[model samples]
Target: MVLLFAALSATTQAQVTATIAQAGFGDLRPSDGFLVQHLQHGPVSIGELADKLGITAQGVSKTVIEMERKGYVTRTASSGDQRRRLVELTSRGWEAIYASRRARAEVNRQLRASLGPGAPAFLDQIHHLAEATGAVTLLTERRLRP
Candidate 1:
């Protein structure tokens, strides 16, 4: 279990670094990528982002402020609720997301190649464990801390 955890951690860190470089988003962190992915679907209110990220509204606001300064995202008053601020990705943010996706795909391809014939079964077992532990839901719904 320790070995598995170490391997996954190392791989994740390397993949994140590679994704950031490939995306030319050195200013963004992995958490930023996760946050922006949510906005890829559509604009979301700050409160909703806080809930989805399992963070405080103030924390989300701080992140939004930084991202806004970087021009990766924009927050505007909601049409229906003037008090609620909706966050959406900018053109640069979309480009970063697309590049990150491509980078991650390449990393997955390399990982599979390294695993060779055992890749499919290994992946299935990993998914099984994740599902059994409810990690799948957590991964999809919230930002995972390393």
Candidate 2:
């Protein structure tokens, strides 16, 4: 019974993630997702994004190069380090990410409404109950593969 529930939850989450990813916010991929996440903290080294995304720096660099061509990101020499470059969103990129976030929020709102007001509290309980076995950890620890 427990395993069945586990499988069901995992399958549901996987499907949800797939659906969200496919939405793609109409871009190549959510490379902007990582950029927006880091940009909140300030500039990030191009190298840092590759590491955080868990892809080869070469892969990340290639994607960034493409995004640069698309004007989704701008790579400028780091103010303090000429040898390094910092990646940042252009105005259009900011617009793109904000649009993506709004899209996700709408999905979340729909989910919450479907689940009812108790859903958030119930989810917290589920997390607590699943703690030692790390069932929910899989959601957070998911390492996307290319």
Best by TM-score: 1
Kindly list the per-residue Cα lDDT of model 1 for residues 46-75, writing each as its tens digit.
Answer: 999888887899999999999999989999
Question: Which whole-number lDDT from 0 to 100 does residue 80 have in model 2?
Answer: 82
Query: lDDT at 70 for candidate 2?
Result: 76
TM-score per candidate: 0.88, 0.65
Off by over 4 Å in 2: 1-25, 126-146
What C-alpha lDDT values do all the predictions have? Answer: 0.84, 0.66
Clashing pairs in 2: none
Candidate 2, residues 8-120: lDDT per residue as tens digits?
65665455455545555355454345545655556678788777777777877787788888777788998788989888877767766666666566666776788897998
TM-score of 2: 0.65
- Record all residue pairs in model 1 with backbone atoms less than 3 Å apart, i.e. clashing: none
Return model 2's CA RMSD, one decimal: 4.9
Q: Which 10-residue window of candidate 1 scores lowest in summed lDDT?
A: 137-146
